[model samples]
Target: MRLRRARTIAAWALLIGSIIGWPVAAFGPARHEPQFVLGLSFLALIVESASLLTASQVHEETGSK
Candidate 1:
């Protein structure tokens, strides 16, 4: 798959996982398990998105060398 599509899918998965996982973590009776994945996934997703955005912008400016 293309990098763009892969990144988009990953971002969505992480976004949704984080969202769903947050509620589960809060209302379920767990202190660490669900929240761990939720927080980490969200953080990784944000970083991935930022990196992808930066790469795209760089490529745009650099003529996709």
Candidate 2:
């Protein structure tokens, strides 16, 4: 239960971070630096992958199917 809850929270944080980070990196002040944008995008991708993994685990535990 605790592990699931922790994963859920981490997944949520990563998902939200990616959602907010992408725009900021693309259009915000950091846009001036190509490296920053690329780095942020990469980070967002990693976060998204992690979130997906956690979400899948949660779904499995819940026996959704």
Candidate 3:
């Protein structure tokens, strides 16, 4: 039960973070602060990917084992 809840929270966080980070990348001085903007975008992508992967894992486990 606890693990399931944790996974749900993580998945939501990842999804939300990705949604929030895109605009910052789009309009936040991309050229002058390429590294920072790119880093945020990369992190957002990673989190989004991880969220999908973790969702599949949760589904496969089906709260069993």
Candidate 4:
């Protein structure tokens, strides 16, 4: 349950961060901070992949189709 909740939160954070980060990195005063946004995007990708692998493990453990 805890893992599930954390994954949900991470997903939402990634979505919201991208929504706000892109604009800030593109046209806002933080135009020079695009690398920060890109780095975060890469981190989020890694986290999401990990979450997928974890889910697969859980499913296999439970013998679920």
Candidate 5:
């Protein structure tokens, strides 16, 4: 249960981080390459997937009869 909660929090943080950071890292005043944006997006997807999986586990464990 704790693990699920921790993972869920981490996933939310990562999701928000990627959302805010992507624009800055990829297309900010520094002007990064397209590959950088793509990579960040890919990483975000991975984090999201993990978050969803953990959340599913938590739901299953505590689900109604």
Candidate 6:
């Protein structure tokens, strides 16, 4: 479990979770508020972006593609 790999996995998980969760929250029987769902999605995206940036930096420091 390298840091880069861990971050990459986390980023992917967040992205996929949001992709699936957004629709479920929007159109599913739960009927969550749109603002709440959008807030959560934005937060997930920000965290995912940070994780990816960190992973990229790690890869750059390690000189690995």
What overall lDDT goes with each candidate model?
A: 0.61, 0.70, 0.69, 0.61, 0.66, 0.67
**Per-model TM against the reference:** 0.46, 0.54, 0.51, 0.44, 0.51, 0.52
Candidate 2: 10-residue stretch with minimal lDDT: 56-65
Q: Per-residue lDDT for 1-65 in model 5, tens only?
A: 66656666776666677666755666665465666667767586767766775785577577533
Best model per TM-score: 2
lDDT of 6 at 46: 61
Best by lDDT: 2
lDDT of 2 by residue, 1-65 (tens): 66666666667676777767777767787777787657867686866768676776766589644
Please report the TM-score between candidate 2 and the true structure: 0.54
How many clashes in each candidate? Answer: 0, 0, 0, 0, 0, 0
How well does model 5 score by local distance difference test? Answer: 0.66
Q: What is candidate 4's CA lDDT for residue 29?
A: 57
lDDT of 6 by residue, 1-65 (tens): 37666666676676677667766666775565666867676577767767776776677567654
TM-score of 3: 0.51
Return the clash pairs for model 6, or none.
none
Ranking by lDDT: 2, 3, 6, 5, 4, 1
Error of 3 at 5 (Å): 1.1
Measured by TM-score, how close is model 6 to the native structure?
0.52
RMSD to the hidden true structure, all candidates:
5.1, 4.2, 4.2, 5.4, 4.2, 3.9
lDDT of 3 by residue, 1-65 (tens): 76667666667676677767666665675646667757776776877767675775677478666
Give the local distance difference test score of model 1: 0.61
lDDT tens digits, residue span 1-65, model 1: 36655555665665566666656766676665667666686577667666655665555556535
Can you tell me which runs of candidate 5 are displaced by over 4 Å? 35-65
Off by over 4 Å in 3: 29-61
lDDT value for model 2: 0.70
